[model samples]
Target: MASPNMQIARNARTRVADRVTSKVTDALKSDTAFESGSLALSARIAGAAAEAVLELPAEARRTLTRRQAELVRGVRRLVETFGDERGRRKIELIVPETVERSVGEGLGPIVPEEEGKHLLNELAVARKIEDWAGTVAGASELNRDYGIPRSTLHRWQHANEVIGLLKGTKKHVFPVEQFIDGRPALGISAVIGLAGSHRTAWLWLRQANPVLGGRRPIDLLKQDRIEEVIETAQAYFDPQ
Candidate 1:
């Protein structure tokens, strides 16, 4: 019943609508790929949808109506997920301002100013002990002063390299007798002797002390002072 030109126009409009709808459906489906272990798929789908919108015919583009807005949003989401270098630039643009706002707002808890000064004094004392020649005393003093558990101090003394570094000068000597008497103990040498290689010693050290950041015991042996190595070996053997 419609004129030929009218029929042609109707068909064109339907085709454009169908194409836009299909693209949106495809974008939605592709978005799920992010949850499916394919990180790149979502980006690709979003890029394609954006391109399709730009390439739409003039008449189709003009008739975009509400559909154009939806397509643009979809493209933006996709770009957010996986846009090229330019997209990353856009994302990072506001980060500095956001950080500034958070700082200005004082986002965290508000303690009394005097309480902060008192905490600093307590921290300085603990730090002084850690820097002294006697690590056990330093650890014990910190434990007592801060009400930190003895077990936690021991765990930190044995497991954390940063704690080790803080406990004494890098050049400080460790006496064999100290190890024998079970003063500063580690069992690296004994474990190595049992396991029959420096490699296994390293593996055990990493497993027992996750804070060492996967460093090998042998590597520690090479870097640490001979006395420190002996002390660490003794502690590992006799961690009581």
Candidate 2:
């Protein structure tokens, strides 16, 4: 019961949606992490495009150039969301600054083709050093190496007062730097709690601080500059 012109316009919109879906899918399929859920997201995008075109006036929807532009904008939005989640996790390892940059740019993918490859290579190297900088130990290792009892460890974890990251099967892995001379370092619990979780604390602890004369917090802690480290952590927790 629709007129021929209306049916033709509807068919054109369907073709635009299909084209956009194909382009978006092709762009994302290269990333293994993206491929899993992308098909479903792409379908949703196509449906959204169809609905959006309907909301436009009939003449606007019939304009091929306008329709193409709309499809491209929808596809870009899809890519941005995918990029943001992937960037948040991987960029933390390669370059922490990239996370802020990505978000500031509206969660868009910030890396160009050549730059992205370079980042991927750096990420591969970073993974190798993860044992020292990013690794965490299980409860048994903590007990053996640092004499931390499972009950006390779990207590801190439950209280959200330690640097244990949950791993496979709900097992918690504590960062090695949390220990010193068979005990948890003084003020570490408070610092961990204050900095708002282990990941943020890890970033603060590992990076050089201008206030500490460019020395790393972990190095100061290793030197038993406990009070200074705590002050630095507090500064980092609530900076000027």
Candidate 3:
């Protein structure tokens, strides 16, 4: 066998040759140049560029590799979190449902003014739902952690005001920190009642409250200060 240095030199030559050939072929196909004799000049320029790329700084290569790894991790998290029933439901919510309607029923091509309004409304709704879902734990994860049936949790979504509605999936998702020791945290339902939606309630619960000495309302609720937290939530929605 040839020595390692010889093998490396051979491989480098092969790569340079490939780049040059490809560039020349592309130039001819485009027919941008009048003379086919310019192929050699184009090939040489392409080969030089390829060699410069191969000689890029080690730090540049490391940065590129790190960025690629981070991108892969981000995509994986998105798939795991939103690629389930919830994601599908969210898609449905954003996409307007087609209902068979007569021209008299205000069902036809959307006018310019109405189209913009409709799009904005859908975007606002999608953002609210996505924000809530991001803060909550999905049914599958909660069920696995607490041995609660998915079906039962879903029923609670309708029965309890503390459950937030998600657009994409039919699954019921609750705030990840809403439960402690497999039991609902105190004051969640009361706050939900005052705030009208779980998203609004969650925002209030998470924010610092003056009455609680600048501590998050959720922290106070976890400490069994249900009445105080509920009062804070009320004040949050309606201040005297």
Candidate 4:
């Protein structure tokens, strides 16, 4: 009953409505994808920044270079703006500064005075290594600090035994001698609680070892030899 022209006009209107709806749906999907991607990227960047900060000496953290502080602040801002508050809370639970300081202090005294000094010097070298490897330090630094040559350091770094040992524990374990104030006491549970990462804890244990000439904590753990952990804990918990 309608005229040909009216039918044509009605068809045109329907097409326009369909196109608008499709476009709106596509736009919403695109926006959601962009938001998710941005959050993920921010999280990765924040995590890396945190790791770098943790590796630095406590004194260095206090006196952070302008650039270093800026980077940390930037990451913090991104995390605050984009990260889910719940997720951020979880990260805080994992790696609190108090735990890091406790582990560092606990491990400090046990390091041979010479080796401890060498590790400090190595931090500068680590800066350069990061440029080449995307990390602040490498096995070479550890090797150099302990007077072990590069090849030996490389071998131990890749050894499965080392990796296993590093993963055996859930917390970072440092010797009492390493304690910042040379405190003679601390509990294993306390040490474990302080160390947020199993690997960091393992590294602390390995560093405290007098043997292996400074092999990584992972390698030591893989070997089923935790004499140092035992000895350190005993010394701390058992005062004559």
Candidate 5:
């Protein structure tokens, strides 16, 4: 077996080789990457220049000059805010989701307006729900802390007895409040069935309902007001 440092080096090389391969493929596929004199895509492209060929996220591809400028400004703000730490080789910078979206939307061909508006709307809604719901934990955390088995939790998720939100790219997180006495809170399945999705159910449950006199649906369920909660949810979905 290789030494740890040797293994690290090998992994680094593998990652670099993969990135180069991806860049080459992007060059071949991108119409904008064709050079005036160079017939070979591989000959003219490498590093940052080659990255220009990679396709942007669908919502980000239509960014105009103004959008690109927003990204530049965001990065500049980060650098200025951390100017004292600039001497360090690397430092992580955290920014709001809107600024993050600008970074992705800053590239690619300028298209018609409002291309990134949908992404912004989605980000805003996610932020609101996450803020209200709060303190989500993964399956392993719940198993370790609450003594609820992962298999049981997964089963509950499948049954819609529990609410699981896709916290990031792929990791699903359940709100701590979803579990009661090591089991899913009562009436969650009913709400999920009515709402049509776990996320929609959870968001609806957490939000203040006008029919329920500004009381959240989840609070009503906790108080054993299942019938009333279900009726309110029905009214919300129907609204006719």
Candidate 6:
């Protein structure tokens, strides 16, 4: 039999768990996109799923075991988050560099064949995005070429004032075009916010937009044509 003190502790833990559950539910319920059936909705659901799975109960374990398909979809939703138009990046690289031999070589022993294949494909897509980010340079190169301090650069990356692409295991590569006059261009942050994620924003900035009269947004940013670039980005990402 459990002692009175032990029972009290258990009740306290249960109450805490209940409160956490309520918060997660309320957050999603109050969201405007809860019923939108958009990626926004999917993202919120994935986050809520993660929080629910964190609960200390047999139901949480059962969720992992019984609702495996939902969990897989949640994984995809989480992956898609790396490209949020709000300019969030330096996301962890969970997949290997190459998909070749990734399956039967090692993963087959663990992940199911179908699941392994899907994981590798996602990895390849991520690598392609990294390539689109252009030839990246480390902090030393950026500082030497741009004359900026490592501390300041790190702060900019943290604040999304500068685009920082996570390339390898734990290193980040910055796009050279993002800088002008030894600082990030005036509209880089805005473009990122309007465009969504670092990968998409960088890709769009590098491409010549017809709306910008065939001028790349990055070039316009360098030239301080911020209004044109922001307008273009807004239309491109949130076209009515």
User: How high is the CA lDDT of each candidate model?
Assistant: 0.46, 0.69, 0.66, 0.42, 0.71, 0.73
Pick out the ten consecutive residues of candidate 5 with the lowest summed lDDT: 41-50
lDDT of 2 by residue, 1-240 (tens): 999999998788767766777776777777677755767586667656766766677788657343453345456776687666543544344546544434354666677899989878887743333554566788998888778899988887776556676565566677776666755556666677778777677677878887667888777776777666776666567766
Model 4 TM-score is: 0.17
lDDT of 6: 0.73
Candidate 6 worst ten-residue window by lDDT = 100-109
Can you write out model 3's per-residue Cα lDDT over 1-240, one digit (the tens) per residue?
999999997688668857776776676766766366566555665576556546668897666444543333454565467536743543335645877856675666767988889888888743554453445667787789787677777666666634565546665467766677675676777888888878677777777765566788787777887766665566667666
Over 4 Å off in model 1, which ranges? 33-240
Among all windows of 10 consecutive residues in model 2, the one with the lowest summed lDDT is: 64-73
lDDT of candidate 5 over 58-161, digit per residue (tens):
55544522244334445456546855764678767886667433345556776555867765677773354458677788999999999989899889888788
Write down the RMSD of all candidates, one decimal each.
Answer: 23.3, 24.5, 21.7, 23.4, 23.5, 20.5
Off by over 4 Å in 5: 1-130
Expressed as tens digits, the lDDT of each residue in 111-144 for candidate 1 is 8999989888888744443233233334455445
Candidate 4 stretches with Cα past 4 Å from truth are: 1-200, 206-208, 211-217, 233-240
Give the per-residue lDDT of model 4 (tens digit) for 169-224: 45212221222221212232333434543344434543534333445433433354
* Tens digit per residue, CA lDDT, model 6, 173-221: 8888678788888888887887778777888899988666677889988
Question: TM-scores for all candidates?
Answer: 0.16, 0.42, 0.44, 0.17, 0.47, 0.48
Q: Which stretches of candidate 3 lie over 4 Å from their true place?
A: 1-113, 118-135, 167-171
Q: Give the TM-score of candidate 3.
A: 0.44
Best by lDDT: 6
* Top of the candidates by TM-score: 6
